[model samples]
Target chain A: MSTLKNGIVCSPAIHAPGEREITFSQAIREAVAEEMARDERVFVIGEDVAEAGSVFKVLVGLLDEFGADRVIDSPISEAGIAGIGVGAAITGMRPIVDIMFGDFTTLVMDQMINQAAKTHYMSGGKLTVPMVLRTTLGASRRSAAQHSQSLHALFSHIPGLKVAVPATPYDAKGLMKSAIRDDNPVVIFEDKMLYQQKGPVPEGEYVLPLGQADVKRAGEDITIVATSSMVYTALEAVDKLAEAGISAELVDPRTTTPLDTETLIESARKTSRALVVDEGYQQYGVTGELAAVIADGAFYYLDAPVKRIGAMNVPVPFSPAMEDLTIPSADYVFETAKAMCG
Target chain B: MTETNGTKQNGAELDAEHWLQAYEQMVRIRSFEEAANELYTSARMPGIAHLYIGEEAIAVGMCEVLRQDDYITSTHRGHGHCLAKGAALDRMFAELLGKEAGYCRGKGGSMHIADQETGNLGANGIVGGSAGIATGAGMSIKLRGTDQVAVCFFGDGALGQGLLYESMNMAQLWKLPVIYVCENNQYGEYTHNSKTAAGSMIGRATGFGVHAQGIDGQDIRTVYSTARLVVDRARNGGGPAFLVCNTYRFRGHHVGDIDRPYRTREEEEEWAKRDPLKLLEDWLTKTRQADASVFERIQQDVQTAVDEAVNFALEAPFPEESEVERHVYA
Candidate 1:
C-alpha cells in the first residue's frame, strides 16, 4: 500500500489466489464492457468496432452486450472520429476511440494534440475531455513500415496527454478502467503482439494507477526498465541473465506520461547498473528519456553508464529477416545487461 | 421606405421582437469587433485578433434560432460566433487582453475562448479545426438522445480542409444533429475562395447526402429564417444540414493586415454597400418595426456596454506566473 509523491500506489494487489486467466484482448473487452455497464456515459466508437469488433478482434463481444448505440461503428476517418471523441467527452460522454494500428495515429495527431490534449488547459480547466484513444503498438508482424510501428513515445512527449503502455493482461484491464474513469485525455498503446498472450487476470474489479511502475522481478545486479512488449523481452532476458550469474531487476513503466520515475530510479539505484528497453525507435524514443532519468537520479550509484535498447532507427522492413534485426530481442537485452554488469 | 408587414417580408417569418433582437445582436457583434480593432490598432491589445466584422449576420442569425444549451464550435475568426452564442462581453475582451478574468484566464487569448456554461465549445486557432469537434458534439447529442443540436461555424476557407468533408460525411451517415455553417466570406485569409476551393460549398455537403442550402448572408432576415429551419430540422431528428452563408470580410484578415493587396478596393466597396447592419436597419425601418431613433438608441447602448467591457479588460490583472503550470491536466 506504499504510495509515491503523486499518491500513486507502488503496487496494487491485483492478483488474488488462483485468479481466472484471460488473453490480453479478452481483458481489454472485459474492461470496456464493465466500464460501459458502470457508466452510461462510457461508449466505444471506431471503425470496425461495432460488428467487426475491431480489426484485431480485441473488442469481440462488446456490440452484442452494449448494443449498437453504445458500441458504434465509424467511417475510416481517424481525425474525424478522434475529434468526435474529444467533443463528446467534453460535452458529457466518455468515448473510447480505437485506431486500428499505431501508425494510423499519424492521421489523428492534430485532433489528439491540438484539440483533445490542449482543450482543458486552453479552456483554463473550464472544460475536460474525458476520452481515451485506444490504439495498437509494436512491430514484428511483418506488416511493414506504415502498419508496423510503435509510436507511443510521440504521444508521451505531449504535456496534457497521459500515455499508457500496459505489458500484461492484468495491467491492461486495470489501466483501461482507470483511463475510462479519468477526466483527462489518455492514450493507451496496446502492443499488438501481446493481444493473444495469456496471463492471469482477477475476477473482482481493480484499477491500476497510471503513473505506477511494476517490478516484474526483483534483483540487485542490473535494472532493466522496459515498456509494453519489451517488458516480456526484458523478463526473458532476466531469466537468461540469472543463468549467467547476473541478478537483473525488471521494471515496467505502465504509463509513460505520468511516468513513475521514483520506482525506476529506486530500482536503478538499488542495482547500481541500468539498461532501458522499448520497442519505439531509438532516436528521441522512450528509452532515451528513461535512460536519462535513471542516469541523473542514480548517477552517483551507477557502476557503468546506463545503456538503451530500442528499435533500430530505420523503417520497419517488410521481410521477416530484416524486421527481426530491427527490434530488440532477449539475447540483445541479455548481452547488453551482461556487458553493463561486467 | 417601402411599407410591408414585418413577418412575411424578406423571407423572415419572425415577429417584430425577434427581428429587433437579431438586429441588436448583429450591431453588438459589429461594435465588439470595432472595439477590438481599436485596441489592436492603438497598440493596447496583445497578440492577433481576427475581426468578424462583415460576417456578423451569419453568427447572429444562426445563433438566434439556437437554445442556450445547444453547442457551437468556432474557428480562428470566431469573435462573432462567441458573442452570438451568449459569451459575456467583459470576459471576451478580457481574454483578448490576456487578463486573469478572461474565459481562459488569459491562456486562450482571442482565438481560444471557450465557455462551458454557454455551450461555446471553443474558438479554435486552427482553420477548420472545430469541424470535427462540432460533429462530435452532434454525435454526443445523438448518443445521449438529446434534442439539442451543435453548430459548426467556419469560413469558406475551411471547405478546403479534409476534416470538414470527413465530418460532414459522418454527420450525414449517422444522422447526427449537427448544422455545418459555412460562412463563405468571399476570401480565405488573403486569397479568394475561387483560387483555394474548386467545387461549390453546398455541392461538397450535398455530395455526402447532407441537406444543403446557400443564402444571402447580408440580409439578416434570410440568414435567420434559413438558420431557424435548419436548426429545427436537426433538432427534430431530420439529420445534419449544411448552411452556406454567402458573406464577405470587410476588413483585412487580421487587424494588422491593413493593406489587403490580395483583394481589390472595388470589391471591398461593393460588399460594403451591402453591410449586414445597414441591410438589417433598412429592413427594420422600411417594415415600420423601429425608427431611426430606436436604431440610434441600440447603437448608443451597445457602445456604452462595449466601452465598459473594454475598460474592465484594461483594468483586469494578468494571470499569476504560477498559473502557467496549472490546468495542463484536469
Candidate 2:
C-alpha cells in the first residue's frame, strides 16, 4: 500500500524492522512510483499505464499517484511510444516506456536500435538517452508464440543496450530503481510467472547496482546459474538437491548484458562443476553465453564441460502440458545438476 | 508592392533584419551542400550523403520561426535542417569525415548527425522515425510548462508510414505543443509520391483532428509565414497542426542515383527553374530590398565558410580505436 521516494520507504515505519515481504509486481511498482516522485523529469508512458494500470498490473497505482500528466496512457503504437521515449530522453526528460510484451519489441527495433541506443554514442557523448524500456517476458499464460517468447538475447546482443532480467522481489525493486536513474537506455525484462512470487524487500533506501550477480545459496558440490523466473526453478532444485546431500550452489545473474561472469567463473573454480538454467530456447540463448564464459574462463576448473538446461529449441506451445514440457522445469535443473555432481 | 519585407508582411510583419538573416541561413545551407558534394565526389568525405538540394527554403523558413530551444526532428536529408536550426558547419563536415570533432563524433555519418545544444533532437535514418520523438518532446515542453514547441519534419514519402499518424493523434488528443511538417518533395527514395500515397497528406493528420495546411515549399517567405501561425498556436496551447509543403528535389534521391531510370532530364530542369534560392534572390532585388552587391557579398561569405568547414574537418582527428565500445551507455 506504500510507495517509495528517493529510494526510501515513504510509508510510516510502523512495521517490524526495515524489511517486509512483497510481491515481484509491487517491488517493480514501488521502484517506478518512487523514481517518479523523486525526479520531476521522470514520467511513465505506455499502453494502459494510466487507466488500465498495465495488463500485468505492475504499474497499478502510478496513474492516480502521479496524475495523468506524469503517467501517460499511450495509443497502441509500439514504434511511436518507443520513438517518443528516445526523443524525450535526449531532450531533457527521463521516460520509463513499457512495451506490453517482449515480442512486440520487433515493432520498436528501429526506435531502440537506431535511435535510443545510438544517440549517446553517435552524439559523441554530447547527448544521452536516460530511459528505461520495461517489457513482460516468458511464456505460460497461453499467450502462444507471439507473446510467450523470452527474447532477451535479441536486445542484449546489440552493443548499445543494457538488458536487465530480474527474478525476485528484491532484485526487481533494486534493479528497477537503478535502471530508472541510469543515463542510458536500459531494458528491464519482468517475467509474467514471477509477478505473484514473494520475497523480503528492504523497507529503506536500496539500489542493486547494474552488472552484478548475486550468489543466492552457497554450497560445494556443484553450481547452478539461473536468470529471471528460472532462478525460482533453480532454487526449488537446490532444495531437492540438499535433501540428497548434493550441496548445490545457486547464482542468479540479475542481468545478462554487462553480465557478472566473474562470479560464475569463481563459483565454477570453487565447485569444479556448473549448470546454467534459462527459460529461453537452448540454441543461441543466454545459456550458451554463460557456458562459453565458464568454458573459456574456468575451463580447467570446470570438470564436467559446464553443462546447461534451457527450454526446448522450439516455439512455445499453447496447451498447459505442452508448455510445461517445453519450459525448463525444476526437475530439469535438478537432473542437470545431479548429473554434473555425479 | 511585392516587397520581400521581413517586418511588414500581412499583419505579422518581421523586421528587415529577419529577411536578411533568413536569406543568409538559406545561402549557407546551399553552400554547405555544394562544398560537401565537391568533397564527397573527391573521396575526401566518406559515406553516402543525402544532399538537401532544391529544398533549402523549407528548413530555413520553418527554423526562422523557431527559437533556439524549440525542438525539430529531421529526416535523412537533414544537413539543411541542422544548419538552419544553428548546427555549426565545421562539426557537420567533421561528422561527414568521421572525425572526433563532428556532431556525432564520427559514429553517425551523414544520415545521423545531431546537435543537442540547439535542440535538434536528431536526423533519423529511419523513415518517419522522429515523429514520435517530436510528439514526446512536445509532451515534455508542455509538462515542464514552457512555451517551446516541437516540429516533426518528414517527406511526402512518409505519408504511408503509420508512425506519423500515431504521433499526430497523441499530440492532438493531449493538446501537445507539436507541429508536423511534411516536406512533399515528390519522392520517397526512388518512387514518386503520387505512386505511393493514398490521399492528401494533410488529410492524414486532419484525420486525427489536428489542424492541417498545404503550401508552396519553393517560396521561403510562404513557409516562414505559414509556420509562424501554426508554431504560435502550438506554443500557446492550441493542439498539434500539420503543414504539407509541396516541394521538389533537383538532385537524385542520393549522390550517385543519377535519377536516370526514374525520370527525364526535362522534369529535373523544370523544377530547377523554380529554385527556392533564385526565388528569394529575385524577391529581394525586385523589391529593392537587396541589390546585386548584397547578393555578391552573401555568396562570398557562404563560400568562404564552406571552405573553412572543409579544412577544419580535414584537420580534425578521428576517434580512438579503443573507444568503439564507449557511449553504448553512461
Candidate 3:
C-alpha cells in the first residue's frame, strides 16, 4: 500500500491509469442517468429540470433519457416539491429534489428539516425517506449574496441529514450515486465554479463511501483539510508551498456530516500542524467545526494551534473584485501555511 | 337536526347496518377523545393534546369511504382520523401515552403518529405541513399507476398557509389523485375563522381549478356521501377536489387552555345542541333503525374498549434510552 512521507497509510487510488476525463457536470449527469436506469423508483423533480435540464445544465439530456414521467418539471415551488419529495420517498419512491439554487433552501427548510429529516426517527424506524436534495454551493460567479452562499454547514448541523460536498468530477459521480442509494435524507452541495473542471473518471460503476476522507497530496510538514471548492484552492497552495520546502498534506473531507475525523486527526498528529479551509463563513462554520475536531483529537501532538481559513464573515459581494477578496484563495492558504510552518 | 339546503342525503339508500357501523365508529372516536382528555386532566399523559371531540362526524364520514390502501395525512388534532382510518385503539392510546408498543414507539407522542400498515402518513405538528405530503402521495400513486388516493386533513387555520395553496395548485395541474379536506371548526386556535380567514374557503380551491364544495359537518350522512363522491372521482383519475366541512371545536385548543375567553359560553351551548353524535343517534331512533337500547349498547361497548386501551398504555413499557439514537438514520 502507498504511504505518505510521515508513514501514514494513504487512501486507495480513485482513478486507474489512462482513465477517461469528464467534466464535473457530465459526471453528475451520468450518475443520475445510471441510477435512474438501475432503479425505476428513482425520479428527478424540480423547476426547469425537464426540458431545461437544470439552470446549470448539469442535468442536460436527462429529460430525453428518463422521459417526462421520471424527469418531472415542477412549478416554482421549492417547499412544495421538497415536501413532495419527502412524501414520495416514504411511500416507496426514490426522489431527487433539484433545487436550482442553494439559496432557495430557506424555502424548503420546513420540509427538509421538519418533515424529511424527522420522519424516520419520529416514526420509530417504520418509515424511511430515501431522498436526495441536489443543489450548488460556493461563490465568485458574480451571482451576488443570495446565490453565492456556501450553505453546506447549515445542513451539516441537522442530525438526520448527510451533507456531501464533492470537489472533483470523480468524487461527484461516486458521491451522487451513494447519496441516491442512502436510506436517509442527503443534501449534496456541488461547487458551481468546479462544474466545468475536468477530471479522470472510470467507465465502470463505482461508489465512494460517505464519511471517508481522500488525501489528494500526502505530505509531512503541515496538514490542510479542505472541503468542496476549497479542495482545489488547498491543492493549488500545495505547489507553491513545495517551493518553500513546506510539504503540506491536502485532505478532502467529501462529506461534512459523516466526517472522517480519524484520518484528519492522524494527519494532524503526524504533521504537528493543521489548517482547515472552507468557502463558508469563518465564524461557527465548517472550518470552526473541523478545526475544533482536529484541535481536540490532536491537541498534544500539535506544535501550534489549529488555524481556519474561510470566507470573510459577510454576504457575498456582487462585484468581482470584492467577491474574490471574500473567499479564501491559493495565495491566502500559501501565506497562512508558511507562517504556521515557521 | 337542522338539514341545510344543498345537503344531499345520498346515504339514505344504505341499509341500517351501514348507518349502525358509522355510528359505532363515531362513538369509538368520542370515547377515545374523552379518555385522552381525562388522562390529560388527571395528569397521567405527558405533553398536550388537541381534542377532536366536536368534529367526530367529519373524520368518520370521510375515512369511511377510503380503501385500506388509500393514504391520509392528518393534523395535530388527529385521533379521530386515526381511529376512523382503522388504527387499532390499543396502539393509538399507547402512542399517546409514549409507550414502546405505541404506533410510533413513543418517538412521536401525540402530534406525529404514523401507522404504515393502515396507510396513515402521519399527524403533523406544523399547521398545513401535511398538504405537500398528501399531494406527493397522490403523485406517487399516479406514477405507480395505482387506483389509490390520498386525503389531506387540515383546519381552517391551514387556509392561511401558503404551502396549502402551492400543494393544491400542483395537485390540480398534474391531475393527481388527492382530496383536500378542510375542517373549518369555527375557530383557528382561540380566534374565530371570520377574523383569521377572508373570502370563501371553497373559493380558494376553486380558484386553483380544483372542484370544491361545502357541507354541514354535523350531519354524518352528508359528510359520508360527499366523501364517497370525491374519493371515487379521485380514485378514477378525476384529479383533486376540496371539501369544506363546517364544524366547531367544542373544547379548548389544547387540554391546558381551559378558560376560553375568545368565544362566549352561550355560543358554545348553541353549537353543542347540534352535536354530531346526538344528531346521528336521534336519526337512528326516529327511523326505528334500532331502538335506544342499540345506541346504549354501542356506547357501553365502545367505553369498555377505550378503558382497556388506556389500561394497556399505562401498563406498557417505555422505550429503552439507547433507542434514542437507533432509528435516526433508517
Candidate 4:
C-alpha cells in the first residue's frame, strides 16, 4: 500500500530504497524513530500519539515499533499533556509532546513556564528537563487566527526555552534531534504549511545546535532575514528581487532564541540595507526586535533605513483572501526587499 | 570520613531517641513560627509569610521517619517543612530575608525554599502543584529500583483540585512509592474547612484504592508512628498511602491578616492551648523522664542557631542586576 490506513506512507523498509524523497512528516517520524531506538529514555506522548498516530500523522507507525510503553497515548486535555510531560521529564524518561496546535499552549502555560522551565533551576541545577514540545504554527489553508498564529515571540521572551523554527525537512529532523538532546526545554515550532514540503534529510542520527543562522543565499544589495514559513517566502522573494535588479541576501536564523546576531550584523554591514519578514503581527513581533537590534549594532554600517514586512496588526482571518493578505507572502517580501534596496 | 547513618525507628515501639528527635523538630518549628509571627507583625519582614505554628507536628512527624535521601514536596506554608527536612538554617533564613545566599538566590523568598541535596524539592505556591511532582518523584525512585519515597505535603484545600485526583490515580495505578500527606490545617485563606473540603479527606484517597489513615496531629508521637508505617510500606514496594493529619494553624491565614474575623478568638485560644511543642515537652518530662535542664539547653541551642542564621542573612549581599541573565539554562 502506498499509504497506511492512517494516511501515512509506509517505512522505507517496506518499499524499495531510493524510491522517493522523504516528506517533512516522514522526516520527523524517522527522527523520532531513530532516536528512540538509540536511547531507551526517549519516548513520545500526546493525544493519539501512539495508537492513532498524530493529528498531522507525524508519529504514524511509531507505536508498532516502540510499543505502547514508550509511545504513550494521553488524554485530550492539553494542560494534562504538558503536565504529564513535565512530570515524565523530571522522572527518568525523556518525553516529546505533540501539541496538536500552537494555540493550545495557552492552556498549559503554567506547566510549561512555571514547572518545566523553573524545575531544574529551582532544584539548583541538579535536575534536567530534556523534553521537546512540538507544535504546529503559521497561517495558511484558511485555518483561522486561533489555529494559524506564529507565536514564537511568546516563547522567545521566556529565558529557559530555546525556540527552533525549522523551515526545511532536513532542519526539522536535525533540530528536533538536538532539542531532544538539550538538557533545557526546547519548543519546536513546525509550520503547518511545510509538513508536506519535502527535501533531502541525511539518514542516521544528526543534530543542529541551537543559536546558529544559515545564510540560504548570498547577495550584496539588501539583507533579508526570515524564519519558519517566511524563510521559504523570503527565498522566493530573493528570486523575484534578482529579476528586478535587486541583490537580496537571505538569512534564516533556524533557531530563534540563540539568535545569530553575528550573521545578522555581518550581512547588514555588507549589504548596508536590511529587511525582516515575520509571519506574526508587527506590533512587538520578532521583526520589530530584529529591527531594533540591527539599528543599535549596525547603525553606522547601513546606507539606508531598515525595513520590516510582517503580518498585519490583526488576527489571522478565516477567509482565504483575508488570510492571504494577513500573512507575509513572497510578493510582500519581494516588494519590501526592493524598497529596502532602493 | 565517618559514615553518617540515621538510627532506624520501627513503628511498633516508641524508642526514646526517635520520640525525642520528633519532639525536638516540633519544638524548633514552633519556636521558629513564634519568631516569624513577631517578625511579621513588627513589619521587619517585607512579604507575607505563612506560619505553620499549629501545624508543626505534621512536618516534624513525617520528616522524622523519612531518610535523608527520601524526597518531600511542600505547600506555600513551607518554612516548617524545609526546616523539619534538615535544610541548612543559614540558607533558609537568607531566603526568608530575601538575601543572595537564599535557596532560590533570593528570587523565591519564603514560598519556594528548596534543598535538593536533602531531598526537599522546593515548596510550590500553587495549591495543588506538589501532588503531581511528588508522584513523579515516586515514579523516578521506583524506576531506579530504589527504596526512596516522596512525601507530598498539601493543605486540605488542595483536596478539591483535580490534579490531586489525577496524581493519586497515577500513584495508585503504578504502586509508586509515595505518601500523600494532607495537613488538614482547617482553613484555606479565610474559607473554613467545612466549606472547602466536601466529603471526607480520607475517602478521597480510599476511593482511589490507596490505603488511607487520619491521625491526631496535635500528638507528635502519634503522627510519627502513623507516618512511619505508611512510609515503610512505600519503601518496601507497597502502594501509595493518603495520610490526613487533622491539625490547625495558630496564626492568621497570612502575615497581612491580623483580624481573623472568620474564626472566633476563643477557638484560636482553644487550639493554642493544645500546642504540640508544649505538649511534647510536657510528655517528655513526665512520661519519658527527661530533665528540664536538657530541654532548656535544646531551646538555647535553637535560639543561638536562629540568631546566627538571621545575622548571616542580613549580612549576605543581594545578587547583582548584571547577573540576572545568568543561570537561565543548565
Highest-DockQ candidate: 1
* RMSD in order of candidates: 3.2, 4.0, 3.1, 5.9
Instruction: List the lowest-lDDT window of 10 residues for candidate 3 chain B.
Output: B1-10
Recovery fraction of native interface contacts for candidate 4 = 0.24
Model 3 alpha-carbon drift over 4 Å, by segment? A1-13, B1-8
- Model 1, B4-39: lDDT tens digits are 474655555556677777788888899999999999
Q: What is the lDDT of residue A286 in candidate 4?
A: 87
Identify the runs in model 1 with alpha carbons over 4 angstroms from their true place. Answer: A1-12, B1-7
Clashing pairs in 4: none
Q: Compared with the true structure, what per-residue lDDT tens digits does model 4 show for residues B1-330?
A: 112223443232655566667767766776776666666777766697898888888898899888998999888999899999998778887777776788878767788787777888779888877776787677667655779988999998888778788778777877889899988889988999898777888999999899999988887877888988899999998989998988898888887778899999999889888888777776666554465776787788888877777778778888778546556787
lDDT of 4 at B255: 74
Model 1 chain B poorest 10 in a row by lDDT = B1-10
Which residue pairs come into collision in candidate 2?
A: B6-B14, B7-B13, B7-B14, B7-B15
Off by over 4 Å in 2: A1-18, B1-12
Candidate 1 TM-score, true structure as reference:
0.97
Angstrom error at residue B226, model 2 = 0.6
Better of 3 and 4 by TM-score: 3
The better-scoring model by DockQ among 2 and 4 is 2
* Candidate 1 root-mean-square deviation in Å: 3.2
Global lDDT of each candidate: 0.91, 0.86, 0.91, 0.79
DockQ per model, Cα: 0.86, 0.68, 0.80, 0.36
Per-residue lDDT of A229-277 in model 1, one digit per residue for the tens? Answer: 8988998898899899999888998999999999999999999999999
